[model samples]
Target: MRVDGLQDLATITRQLREQRERAEAEEKARREAAARLEAERQLFSRAVGQVHPLTDRNLAELPTTPPEPLPLQHWLDEERVLMESISDDFDVSSLLDTDDQLSFRRPGIGVEITRRLRSGHWSIQRQLDLHGLRVDEAREALGEFIRHAHKLGVRCVRVVHGKGLGSPGKSPVLKGRVQSWLVQKKEVLAFVQARPIDGGAGALLVLLQPARSA
Candidate 1:
């Protein structure tokens, strides 16, 4: 008698054979699609190769066009005119007034800070030496250095302007200039002549105001 629910071996074999046939058909379709795509690529390549190639003469005969001038030229010209109109005079005596040792503090700032700076109370975080630089170069360097130090929240710094022994008459030209520049900067809270161990009269210890949180 036949079983109520179980399939016979012949029925299972037939089902497997049908599944294998379906898989083979799908594989054959995929191969045909790939072959068609390769043929189309070959046709496109041949068409591209038939187009004319350009020679050196064709490239050489092309128009020689200059790039457009920058729009900043107008602004630079205006700046030049403005600079030319300004006077090139200042009170030399005011800039050169440092009595025995270099020192200065802005209004409302205590003299104790300058004393502490001179006595090496603060650790020197950075130093800039203006030994061989020209006046213009020194000024630019000093301004940039101070601004950068202020931005980085640096509190104490040293500036070595040198004794200027090589200058004519052995006068310390940069020393006075540095003192003048430091006083003018808003970031400079106080400055004093360095001690003997810190370059003495040749260098200065500067105290910078802490950068305000933005």
Candidate 2:
């Protein structure tokens, strides 16, 4: 009976020791967690990207997106782009010899535009026909688009209002709308009807004025 009692006492002592050890382990874990929290708070205060994580809103607000790229004009900063230097007297015949044609495959111009677009330096616009948009609607949309283009450092853009011949009416509605819209926007530096090799009657070359960057 004595032996059994001693054994029970030893077992109880071991169980108590385990409970004490567990309590110590929990306290240690809490201390470590507090230290980590302090470090995180310090980082949030110091780092630009590291925002306080208490609110889910901060996570959403943190910029996962890349920065705005440099403008294409910056690359050849040595060279100036003068509108006067490039001729305004563009002949339709010079670009196209036939009714069905495309000649505006100016590699030099295309390369420049592509490079600018690829570099995220400039905005390249490709608009579909204003098939359904009313004059006021088209004007409003074009105005907003041009404003955005200017902000994005877009110098040259292609506005595509498809050749209306394919549509019911012989009159080119979108083409006229684009031309009229361009005329109104002062941000438009200079634009000409696209060369035949390009979109020809269906498109216009838009030159956007740059906006002051923050």
Candidate 3:
């Protein structure tokens, strides 16, 4: 008799939960559909609108990082190097004049040196340590240079035979020999040591006079 009529509260509660879940799922689906429709509308409007080419002017939807500025010292060094390169090719130093007392010379010597310098009687300073040739070999090479320079009737010339301060103890060989050979040469007008920037004492600035009109 007790089992004849029975009602389960758990079954009733389970049915109610399913109905609420279904309603919530339907609401969520509607919201998703509305969002998708809005996105489609926006895309269609953009397609109809004039498209903008990428430019530096505006960045409404993009993120960008700023570039780093160049360092001051590096920028200055580059500028100096560029000026030096131009000077090497164009001989711009010839146009400049320094009027310091130390730089003053006899009017006659000034005129001569300026004329020769303007006429390209100069050579850039260079190190010959890499060659590592013996004194005899260097003497031979120097003789060849002298011959060639004399043949050219070059009034003035510079030879950048480097300062040899290598090893524990040794007098620089090429430097002395070069000076001696120039002294012995009858054709040599005068020779003087060069300034540091010009090649220092390692190089000699030799002057000649048009190979004696022969």
Candidate 4:
């Protein structure tokens, strides 16, 4: 009986020791995991410095209205009419004076008008520079300018059709064309080569008829 009691006591002592050891190990593991989690949180805090949330006042408003549409068809019609009104085939030599400037005066306009134009009797109200423009472009622009100026009662204007030093043969390309175009327009009364102060051979001083009362 005494030997059996001793064996039972030894087994109970061993079981208690094992339970204590397991509890100590679990506590150590829990502490180590908490320390690691705290270290990781500190590292993240250092990397992300600081942050700020945007407020409603900082937001931008979007545009509520659409842009105006272009008058594309109207422009196209105007360009077409301009193209048809002026002719490149019009002969201007018969209308020009025999002077060195090759000035022109409409029928019944008289040589006095050309002389007045050459002497700058009328102030140049507007000027169109056709340098570097293609032939078709220059023609359209010239037509539009002349019609507009005549409509607004502009008496005189300058048309600069560059001396054409850049052309294939160093000849002025738009000079003859401009003269012909001017002769065809009823609005043009006379045109004289610009004087030395106003671009010399590279431009013309044109006189437009006063606009009729509406």
Candidate 5:
């Protein structure tokens, strides 16, 4: 009976030692984890420096989309006005000077200008061909071309009305109308029949007024 009692005491002592060792190991691990956490906090603070959170009042909400654009209504209105300004009914016979080659000069412009234009004195800087376009299309295209050329400070240009060889009964349809249109435009200073080498009777040499300084 004494021997069994001693063996029981030995077992109890061994169990107590194992429990104490386990408790110490757990405490060591907790300390190591706490040290690592403290080191990480110090490193983050050093890297980032100090920061302040933004207040809600300082924030701005960005728009998801942009504003709508403007329509080209004004340009269309100007085009309509331009179309109405020129007319085929305007008589140009009185305005043209009777010479070997027909020519026109705006009133107040010297006759020498028309003579020079007829003689190809000014270099042709631009040209517009109304060969295949209908009457209305030709007028609109001619108006835009003249305006654009004058705006760019072009002094000389050519307008090819195609000599009417292909028209009904072989008559030039756009020639007289084109002359009337040119006379109506204030930008035209003078215009004369092109020389034989420059489309001959099929075209007119036109001189434009110098663009006004802005």
Candidate 6:
């Protein structure tokens, strides 16, 4: 009976020891968490006392009013009307005539216009050079140039299609092709061979029609 009582006492003592160990482990974890929180609080307190230097001391004054929006709806309407006016079946037959020097003018375009263009009467607003570009590249460039110039109301522009000096067989290839391309575009009213000072036979002075209003 005494031995059994002693055995029960030892088991109870072991359970108590395990309980204490667990409590110690939980207490250690809580202490560590509290230490971390205290460290963070100290860091924040130090930052609160320090003054940060201003990076943008010379800041510009802000505008009082917002920018006015663009007239997007009006612009789109104008563009649609312009597109409808252009006919897909435009007669290019009149543009096919090739003179000795190679120049073209749309039908109904007076000879005086061509004469003025050749004589540098119209101011060249923009110029494009297709010196080393291939045929496909040159074609795309010319199309974009003419379209953009027409939209911007540019009346005169110069295109330098470098004389056959660098081309194979020493013949100007783009010189004739450029004329053909210009004739196809409805925006181009007339084109004449440039004068000697303005690239001569190597380039063309094109007169563009003014863009229609909305």
Give the Cα lDDT of each candidate: 0.81, 0.59, 0.56, 0.91, 0.90, 0.83
Clashing pairs in 1: none
Query: What's model 1's lDDT at 180?
Result: 69
lDDT of 3 by residue, 82-151 (tens): 4432111223222223432112122245656744543446652222221377756765565556556776
Ranked by lDDT, the better of candidates 2 and 5 is: 5
Q: Estimate each model's TM-score.
A: 0.57, 0.39, 0.38, 0.62, 0.64, 0.55
The C-alpha RMSD in Å for every predicted model, in order, reads: 10.6, 18.4, 18.5, 17.9, 11.2, 18.8
Ranking by lDDT: 4, 5, 6, 1, 2, 3
Error of 6 at 6 (Å): 92
Candidate 4, lDDT over the whole model: 0.91
TM-score (C-alpha) between model 5 and the true structure: 0.64
> Which regions of candidate 6 fall more than 4 Å away from where they truly are?
1-100
lDDT of 1 by residue, 73-168 (tens): 899977854553322133334532265774787778877877788778999999999999998789778877998899999999999999989999
Q: Which ten residues in a row have the lowest lDDT in candidate 3?
A: 85-94
What is residue 66's positional error in candidate 6, in angstroms? 34
- For model 2, the local distance difference test gives 0.59
Q: What lDDT is reached at residue 39 by model 1?
A: 91
User: Which candidate comes out best when scored by lDDT?
Assistant: 4
Clashing pairs in 2: 102-197, 103-197, 104-197, 104-198
Better of 3 and 5 by TM-score: 5
TM-score of 6: 0.55
Worst 10 residues of 1 by lDDT: 84-93
TM-score of 4: 0.62
